[model samples]
Target: MRENKSAVLNRFFSRNTFRDIIDSTDDEIYKSVILRYVKNPENKKNVELISEIYTELKKNYRNEYYYKNTLLNKLLLGVHSINTTVALTEIPISKSKADFVLINGKAIAYEIKTELDNLDRLENQINDYYKAFDHVSVITCKENLALLENKLEIINKPIGIYVLQNNGSLSIIQKPLKYSDSLDKNIIFKILRKSEYESIIMQVYGELPQVTQFKYYSECLNLFLKVDLDKVYELFIAQLKKRTKVEKELYQNVPYELKFLTYFMDLKEADYSRLNSFLYNQFGGM
Candidate 1:
């Protein structure tokens, strides 16, 4: 398969595709990609087809999904336990969207630059993440490693780097050190939801801001700015850690290829049962 066909693989691995399977909804993407890519898919279970396609994507394409799923599998699940760690995807921070974020004791933003991706906005993306996070890293394939390293040299902060080798292993090219000089309180405040910052205000100030509904937000911001930035960073990490929690047993039984999707799907027990049934069933026709 050519690299330009990544969109087809992207659709095949998307949340919408798996949502169709769990909800028993029909989508043409499933049948089209399966028939086009997998041989004798009719006889194989959905899980097997998924594994085969994932392997192909890893080997040939190495698109953004492959990088994220691999990180979640290798770093989040492989190195860190789900019970203690939280992984967030596609989080908007300042001018850029953070590709993947891992929050254990400290939060680090991972910006993925696959071979298919360009570095036109990498500097801006890295700068945006530092406002809300202390540690930041860029994960890219071996082809882009030298360019990324050269790019980082002129950038003032200590940003770490990792290479996703062709063999599907994450290698730490440069370890990131904690840098807090760029932490902006207002940017950090904006990253939090109303309830999150409110909780922080109550904890630190012991009272919610008392103002009109229109002014309440600004007043809360003013109050938040008064708190120490380091303290604010700690509270921010604590709040984000509560956002996404997964069902341990259900997540464990899910195929490795689908772990990233399953983690973000916010699956209920009934949904898990439905997905399990779908995975075990042969394609038959769809």
Candidate 2:
């Protein structure tokens, strides 16, 4: 127990230790962990049957990545697959942002709160999401489930709640109810880049304002404000669908541990390939 694989894993991933590994100019701990994993991946991950070991280390930072990887795994296994384009991550709404916002026919925002995260800003985050999306879910670990439930009751928002199970899957505690908000068209338009707005306007109205860069924003805003809210929403969803058709091949070669980071977080192809090679190299015999 003193120097076993799990003990090393727990310590290596602890908040302070991880910080030291990151902050150090040249930390041997980082190299040793990676080398050990490359040589024998299974030994470090003994928590599958050792529930208490996992429970004690649940609050670690790396587990934040692990939890999301689990959630992505859950999404892949369930009705949601890699087929539909996951439009955005860290989607800015009112003030805060959604962790993952999947858009195809419908927009569903997922807000992740790892065990290490505080719920202090959750209310405000939920409120911001409501302004843009109809369906919003707060994904947290089992430890925070009750606190989220109580907070949900007080806020009275039809936000969904999901708990990360010990088996590395998500379970819905409260199903989210979608409520259509009379969203400001200006706000909706703000979500789009200048060229996206321009493209939509050209397609819909067959015209773009003949103005200088300085005057272009005001002109675009005027034009967007005149467009009906429903039309704007429809066009937004369509643009999202068109813009976000992900290359399935990239995900085809993705590592299970980095699934969320690769797909959901939009890791650069080069970086993903590097990570995939580093991790999967061992799988095939490094």
Candidate 3:
């Protein structure tokens, strides 16, 4: 397939594609990818075909989504309990968007450099992430491991490194140590939404900013800057954990391949039911 065609196939792991599937809405990209990838679509259910396609992608593509899904499966679900952890994606920090963020007791930022990705912006991206997150790590493929290790070592930062092994396991190359030297209150404030920051202010000071709507943001930011940075981080994690809470029982039923998408989809109970049905249905049956 051409690059353009492969681009269409990549949508299989996207949230919009799963949303369409759950809603039973016909998606051109889904149909096209399925038809092209599945050898005999007559007997295979949607879920089976998706798993097969994902397996192939892991071997060849190894795109950002593949890294994220593997992390969510192995680290989030396998290593930590979903009930105790919260995973966020594409979180903007300073000038870069963090690929994956896991908030357990403390937050860790993961910057994924897939085999297809270049190291051009990695240093700056890691710097930006440290403004808000204390622990930072780089997750890459085996090919990029040594280069990343050497680069990070030269920088002499406490950043950790992990390689997504071909056998589908995360190998810890270096464990990240907590480095709070770079934590900036202003940058942390920038990551929060108005409501989240407002909640933080209320919890800490027992009231919102005492200013007009025009000055509300500035007043809140000024107050946030005055609060202890460590307290702010604790509040930050508490606030973010509340952002995406799913029913544990229902989420446990979500397939491993779709865990990343499902976590960020904000799917309701009805949507899960529809998705469950769609996953088990054959192309003809659907």
Candidate 4:
């Protein structure tokens, strides 16, 4: 008489964005929900338990948000490691930004195409990502997978494809061929800040241009464009990875869904504190 499973799922999906989930850490409201689906995933959910929840999600939601959050959960719970840095979301590149990006040994950009999204910008998105990332993949539902694959081939691109499986796990259908050509230096440095670019120039190339303050950005861009891309990207990844350092407690215990929000979204200190309050109580932390 308490409630039904679908009712619970409906409420859960409504708690979609970061603000909805962490309004108050005192209630431990998100506590059980996270532990069941994500925390200590293997030790927490058996085959029967996993199947029940996965089935409900597929039946109830067939959009980009559901698919991406599920894939994020699986990746964070399954693929993440202490040595490897768990990373960014909606990251800007050139004219476009990737839906999510993970950094460890190499940069991998994931573009999400739900049944609800259009393919008009897929090609353009992949172009921006390939220049900056070592590997780029599109994660789509089955309905869009074939169409996306055909479009990728029509354009003669080597982007990979991963189909979100019915059971809420991601399977790599096509491996993204590693891009080996020299990247556009302007596009690469454009993703960095003034300080970041200045730091890289000083460290790797020995010095920055002592140009007029008005021309500093242009001169720096030109100098960065002239530097060897391999070395530039090495410096870029190092700089990007350094940003993932969070409060040690938060780093160890933040929810997979909230980790991006807690670390990279640049929330005000009050909101960050709200999210941090749950750190000491997480199931598989550290």
lDDT of each: 0.90, 0.64, 0.87, 0.66
lDDT of 1 at 152: 85
| C-alpha TM-score for every candidate | 0.97, 0.74, 0.96, 0.71
The residue-level lDDT of candidate 3 at 115 comes to 88
lDDT at position 149, candidate 3: 81
Q: Give the higher-TM-score candidate: 2 or 3.
A: 3
For every candidate, C-alpha RMSD to the true structure in Å? 1.4, 6.6, 1.4, 7.6
Assess candidate 1 and give its lDDT.
0.90
Q: How many pairs of residues in model 3 come into backbone collision?
A: 0
Instruction: Please give the distance, in angstroms, between residue 216's alpha carbon in candidate 3 and its true position after superposition.
Output: 0.9
Worst 10 residues of 3 by lDDT: 1-10
Q: Indicate the worst ten consecutive residues by lDDT in candidate 4.
A: 42-51
Model 3 segments beyond 4 Å from truth?
none
Candidate 2 lDDT by residue in tens digits, 1-286 = 4347555664543434323422432344444544554435444422221222334345333355466556666764355767764546666776887777767568878888876678898888887777777788888888888888888788787888888876566788888887658366766777888788998889777999899989998898888778877788788777766655445777676544435544643445664455444443322212
Of candidates 4 and 2, the better by lDDT: 4
Per-residue alpha-carbon lDDT of candidate 4 for residues 199-279, written as tens digits (9 for 90 to 100)? 998996798888899999998888787777889889987777766554544354555544434555545556556655534
For model 4 the TM-score comes to 0.71
